[model samples]
Target: MRFDKYNKKTRAETEKEMIGCLIVITCALVYLGYETEWGTIRL
Candidate 1:
């Protein structure tokens, strides 16, 4: 009983994409966190 009639994406595929996005976001967040910390110390 899928309500999404127009989109045909499967659950596994969606989860994989979501995980990939999360990985990228996490990496960016970590990098930014470290950069800000280092920048504040260097100031």
Candidate 2:
């Protein structure tokens, strides 16, 4: 499926988008992990 925002993207551009998404997700997870006080763990 096309990303609605973009009519077309090259394979290289698509791969770059995927990599960028993963990096953003990984950083967010790490930040949350640090922000959490694991003492008895409460969400």
Candidate 3:
């Protein structure tokens, strides 16, 4: 029973970290999309 509880806690912590990383990456992509002048320039 004790081992099961520890496993659950570890799994939750890993999931939280993954979510935080995904959010950070998503924000970075959005910021880059708006920061560049790709749409305003002509070829």
Candidate 4:
């Protein structure tokens, strides 16, 4: 029972880390897109 609780906690932490990484990656992509010419629109 204790092991199961520990495993659940570990999985939750891993999920949080994964979410944080995804957020960082999304921000980096946005930054790069703005800095690069690909994400631009001209009127």
Candidate 5:
């Protein structure tokens, strides 16, 4: 029973970390896209 509880807690933490990483990656992609668009307009 204790092991099961610990496993569940670990899974939840892992999921939260994964979600945070995905959000960061999405923001980075958006920033890069905007940068490229501006660069093209300037050229």
Candidate 6:
């Protein structure tokens, strides 16, 4: 029973980390897109 509780907690933490990573990746892509667009306009 204690092992089951520990497993559940670990899964929750892993999910949170995955979500955080996805958000960071999305933001990075958006920033890169804007930078590329501006670079083209400037050129």
Report, for every candidate in turn, its global Cα lDDT versus the true structure: 0.69, 0.72, 0.68, 0.68, 0.67, 0.67
lDDT for predicted candidate 2 compared with the true structure = 0.72
Best by lDDT: 2
Q: Candidate 3: what lDDT?
A: 0.68
The deviation in Å at residue 21 for candidate 3 is 0.3
Residues 1-43 of candidate 5 have per-residue lDDT tens digits of 2446557567668778889999998787776664554462211
- Runs off by more than 4 Å, candidate 3: 1-9, 34-43
- Each prediction's RMSD over C-alphas, in Å, is 6.0, 5.9, 8.4, 7.2, 7.6, 7.6
Q: TM-score for every candidate vs. truth?
A: 0.56, 0.59, 0.56, 0.56, 0.55, 0.55
Clash totals for all candidate models:
0, 0, 0, 0, 0, 0
- Where is model 6 poorest over a 10-residue stretch in terms of lDDT? 34-43
Candidate 6 residue pairs that clash: none
**Candidate 1 has what TM-score?**
0.56
Q: Pick the candidate with the highest TM-score.
A: 2
lDDT, candidate 4, residue 10? 79
Q: Per-residue lDDT for 1-23 in model 2, tens only? A: 76667758777898899999999
Error of 3 at 22 (Å): 0.2
lDDT of 1 by residue, 1-43 (tens): 4639726888888788889999998787776664554463221
Q: What would the per-residue lDDT of candidate 3 be over residues 1-43, giving only the tens digit for each residue?
A: 2446557567668778889999998787776664456562222
Question: Could you give candidate 4's per-residue lDDT for residues 1-43 as a string of tens digits?
Answer: 2446557567668778889999998787776664445655322
Give the range where candidate 5 is weakest over 10 consecutive residues by summed lDDT.
34-43
